[model samples]
Target: MLSKRVFSLLCVAGIAVNGIGLFSGVMMIDGALYALIAKNMVLSGNYEFLTLHGFDWLDKPHFPFWCTALSYRIFGIHDFAYKLPAFIFWLIGALYTYLLARRLHGRNVARIAVLVYLSALHLLLCNSAVNAEPYLTGMIVAAIYHFYRTYREGTFSQLLFGALWAALAVMTKGIFVLIIVGSGFIVLWLVRKEWRQFLNYRWYAAVALVLVFILPELYCLYRQFDARPAVEVFGQTHVSGIRFFFWDSQFGRFFNSGPITGHGDPFFYLHTLLWAFLPWSPLLLFAVYFSFGKRRVAMGHPLLWGSFLITFLLFSASQFQLPHYLNALFPLVSIWTAQLLGNMGRLPANGTMHRIQWYSGMVIVILLCALIVLFHGSGWWVFGIITVGVGLAVLVLTRRVSPSNTFLVSYAIGLLIGIFYGGYLYPGLLTYQGGDRMARFINAHIAEEHYPDRLYVLDLEIENFMLGFRCEVPLQAIRSEKQWDAINDGSLLAIRPEALGEIPDRFEVEPVASFGAYRISRLTSKFFYYRTRDAQLGEFRLVRLKKR
Candidate 1:
């Protein structure tokens, strides 16, 4: 085991390296969308309801936006400031994960759990994206930890705090927080045959507290959508925000019966897990195998398996799913995966688990090296050199260390890779984000021209929020030709280049600047060849229009 000083040093280094992501550029769609909403909330002084380009956006609850808006109020509106709250919450999640693991296993295993969580590849990636998952993950784990304490010690304070955290989790991502928190406790109760725990009135009081805490979200929904007759959402009339939040948003998505639907592939999450939790995926797989195959169900926390399985099955069966949706359960996985690694002394160096760990470490390093070569081979020589050097050092150190210390070395390597990705590769990729570039262009030109304080702006087909957020201005979306005609000559307009062809003859247009834009996650050789090599994917234009 590592000494306290060494563990503290490692943790500080890991966090400092991981924290490099705060300065990385805002991500596409979701990241930019949330930032924009928060920005508007601060700028417009309307904090109760959510909006997307001046339209009622009832897709998500207001808690996250409220936090972000509050952050902007204090930190003065930068990408780093916008993400600061979520990052802090992520740290809280690590702390809560440690507490929960300490209760389930022992101190050594709990430390391992914390290390595994801090170094998980995707968790750090999510840090840069600054989406709802960070908030949800933190609160859900906190709720679980406190609720577990309540069950173990039968304390009303623990129950109340757990319920409060659960309500915050729900505020972050709707009623799904209940499923994420409840499923594990249900399983734990079942395994322990604690039927009387459910019979306790304190539990019902906790539920009531949850409902009471979620009143703000409910009020916002009512004020925004349900207070009136009907509201338009996703081009549909008479949509109810409360109904969507209470039912359709969670269950409808799970059942694929909601308005927002997608094709469900049963094996989607099976493959996604391989990379999402790298350097630890194989260990987690082995833990599952040995736990079930070896009939070691008595080993580790039963809640881990129950929560992981329930979440895995729910998302896998859902028609609409994303890789990051599993983030909230990763803390549980870390504790469970750490159970085996914490007890590594029982197994020999030649054991199958050790071999898998060795192979997994090698695979993670090699894959990172290959990705760096393929995507950022030339420009990031410093990062490349450091990554290769650290990877080799980790491999060498793994051989020299005891089996227990070997996992630490592997996760350290993962943390280093995360640093390289977040600090170097992500910023490099952001250069290709056309909307951000266009927004910068607009900023400079708008400043140079010294346009009026309140310039009428129209957004067309550039449905991204990055432009408004980066330009530091409120923009109205032009929904029809009438709105297009309403734009004044001194006003500015942004449009997708494809929409330029549809411009009416009544207006004379001058394109001031154009920036190429595409989704980084969708990058492919064909896309690179056409979009980068041939410059054909799409462009965003800042155009000046005058009636002809």
Candidate 2:
């Protein structure tokens, strides 16, 4: 049997392995979108509102872009530079998760919570993707932890830190941050029936601090939209940025009254949780069920129950929802799951723990086999071997490890899978994201003395910011034949095959290159099946329109 120190060291090693692909894969659309915005922020010296495609952008707040812009300044524009800040925030979140879990449930449960938070499949996926979620997740958790510390210890410093963290979260995503961070205090007060907690002068002070910290965000918004100067937005003019930030962005979407709408079936999150929390989903579900087996069990941690349920129900009610929106609540999930696992270990050796371990082991093994089969032909033979080795290690450890440590073993398996995918498989898959490839070709051509005076994007449907950033040229949207008249001898045009309805006899152009292309995020089962069988989705062509 391994010593406790040996087991602990293995767990740490597993986490490091999971982090191996922290910045390997090429940036996807959302990631590239932020990267381009930050690149522009540094280049154009505009640090206020986010901008995309040379337009006023309002889909998200400025903190994430600001951080990325700062990272760009420090590291000089690269994929790692764009992602470094968010990854640091993600680490901060994990640290706070550990500290908060320890404060509530002691050291053992805290360790489990940290492992749960880090090894979460979606969290690992987002770490590489470099989205707002990483920043929000970190800040939200930090805020919650500090707030909870204030509630328990009545530390004024904790309250101040909590308010500051909360402000950062709000700055990152907007008003929705309140719903997530405040829900814990509201739920705790209600559960304990502590009316004084609400009336506490510190609560008011915390709010004031939050407002002060968010002044920069407000100032930026005011300069961008509230100047009373009309700006076109969402196909309309004179749109109010502050109104969108406060009302339309958060509540309007929640109540289905926003300009941006989606098919919110009320149960979208229920199904999404299954895949988003993979390898650990079964355990999480069991923890939920286990908690409900006793009366007033949830009342113990009003913070967790309040944050999880409020965020869950709010998203369920929203007209527009994405799975990552649920990320803010995952820290609570990790804490709850950790406590549940820790409690299970204290009880007499039972069928329940063994059953969970057995089933989880089987799931991991099956997933490994599936991944091996899926990528077998990709010539990632090294990853396949590593997968097999990890699978074998998991199988052996399931029987050899103590029941108390089974959860850690399961987490290691998930992390192993994450390492393989994030480090090896995903990067290999990104080669099919053809816009970046085509952009490189164009960029190389432009580097050779022939600088294109103008660039045209003829495919309205394919809006790849990565392509624009890579081309290092201003992209002009070609809307009509009248726009075609502006093309000159030094003009470059990129068009999707389907977008070109007919070839004009009068137009003289020469093809530079053509690529089989599709969005990496849009890769589906059919795409993989066809790809393994050597098929193409569509063609993207780059041409030079001759000067007439």
> Highest TM-score: which candidate?
1
TM-score per candidate: 0.94, 0.92
Alpha-carbon shift of residue 355 in model 2 (angstroms) = 2.8
lDDT by residue (tens digit), candidate 2, 499-524: 55554555666777887776767667
lDDT of 1 by residue, 371-421 (tens): 666565336567677778888877776764465646866677678778778
Model 2 scores what on Cα lDDT? 0.75
- Model 1, which residues run further than 4 Å from truth? 294-298, 348-350, 377-379, 452-463, 526-537
